[model samples]
Target: MTYCLALKMNEGMVFASDSRTNAGVDQISSFKKMRTYNNGTDRVIVTLTSGNLSITQSVVNLIEQRANDPDVPNVWNAKSLFDVATLFGECLREVRKETAAYLDQTKVDMGVNFIVGGQVAGEPQRLFLIYSEGNFIEATEETPFFQIGETKYGKPVLDRFMQPETTLVNAIKCALVSLDSTVRSNISVGLPIDLVSVKPNQFEFNSQYHITEDDAYFSHISTSWREGLTTLFDGLPAPDGFESNTQAAVTESAQPLGTPVAQTSTQHSQTLTPASVNASVAPVQPSSTQTEAESSSQDNQSSAPTTSLMHAAQNNQPAQRSPAVAANQQNTK
Candidate 1:
């Protein structure tokens, strides 16, 4: 198993992945999970993989082979990010076809996931998560990031902080914090992380850093974030109606052989109205341009029929008018 994360932000894009693969406790190994293909400043494609190491490696090999082959359509010749994604999906499928039989014979599952992020010339930076089946989904404003293996432990931090308009620096910080949380929770993920950042329309990545165990900045962030979390947890209010009892039970649970009492809510419940629920949920504001367009449409809808009627009456001849109006018009004429 591995962990790969990629973020698409307004400022740029950030990509990070770990480099640990293991078949068993005794067969642990390390391999670079991040790969980049740059085509003479015209485009740059970065790929991170997680899951069955053999399958992923095979997929990578296929991509590289086709990319360099001149005779075949590959990342270099792909016209758009969507084209690149399609190429990747095709490669993944080919690898599966070639290796599935052998892997089945060996009783190993052919599970692989890829997070691909980059830009082609004249296109905005995009991110995609490609599955083993060769299909993918793009990241968008509503969902501005993607993660591959061991994602659950790190997802909460991302859900709390990531946004399409987040700064690149802040996004990187969040990614690191997320990776730290995952590393602490799972042994399959480890240090020597690969990080890359690309500015929109730049055609090349702006920053690439390899964070090892001895990296000073990473160490500082990891420690500070952990301390901050502990402090924040400590500062939260205990549940009402059981504050003292809950604290006592928590303390007892920490003891070696104590039977701690389970804390249960004793407070009266209040029925929630739609307005209350709406107030609790965050409000999403529409763009100013959309609001303006809506207002203009309303104005046009209100005035269009009246203007049409007046123009029609002015253009009409005397006999074209209705009988009641024609009689009054003849008397005026």
Candidate 2:
């Protein structure tokens, strides 16, 4: 598994990818997931890759070999970013065709996902996400970013922070924050990250960084993010009575995100104090009888009131029988 992300902003584009590769816990290794091909004067292309490294490496080598040959269409001579994206897809298809059958026999997959972006002279900068099948979708204004490989852990920060109008350095910071989120949560993604930035029409990289565990800035990002989350959690107002009772509160129970915070609340969720519960219970409900028996006697009563009583009961409170309920029970008796 890997984590690679690209942000296409109005200022330009920002990209980040981790370097860890592994077949298993013992087979861990480091390899670059980013490839840059540029002439500096007329064209620039950067690609971040995930999935089978062999397939991607082969595809990249093929593109480079063809670019230098001059006898074939390449990034250097491509008419636009669209044309270059087509070339990238074609290269992936070629590599897949060559390796697919043999790998299939071994039940091994040949999937390789790519995020390719850059500019060609006289054309606007563009970004694309190329799948293992060589087809892709371009980044649009609505979603000016693309991510590939072990993407979920880092996506929340990007969804929260990134936008086309975001500044280049700010986008870079968000990318690092996203990477930190993934690197800490998943063992398959380790670091020594590669990051690149480009400004529109620049035709070359504007900033390139290789961040390792020891790098001060990256270390700060990782430390600060964890600390910030800790602080945020500590500062939140917990549900009433959650902190006071140690064993029987939320910490001791199995709960999901959708459940209400205060389990023992009724009366429209606001009146949940133990004293209120007792006061509400003692006055209206009589002992040694089912509330349902009394409710049945008041069949002519409107369902709206009975529904309200049941709703409160389901909220872990005593069901309050109204005056009509007591009169109904008397008539039934």
Q: Pick the candidate with the highest TM-score.
A: 2
lDDT of 2 by residue, 122-162 (tens): 98889999999999999998999999999999999999988
TM-score on alpha carbons, each prediction: 0.72, 0.74
The TM-score between candidate 2 and the true structure equals: 0.74
Model 1 Cα lDDT, one tens digit per residue, 73-142? 8888888889988888998998899878888998888888988889988888889999989999999999
Q: What is residue 160's positional error in candidate 2, in angstroms?
A: 0.4
Best by lDDT: 2
Off by over 4 Å in 2: 240-333
RMSD (Å) per prediction:
27.2, 12.3
Q: Write down the lDDT of every candidate, Cα atoms only.
A: 0.83, 0.85
Candidate 2 clashes between residue pairs 3 or more apart in a chain or in different chains: none
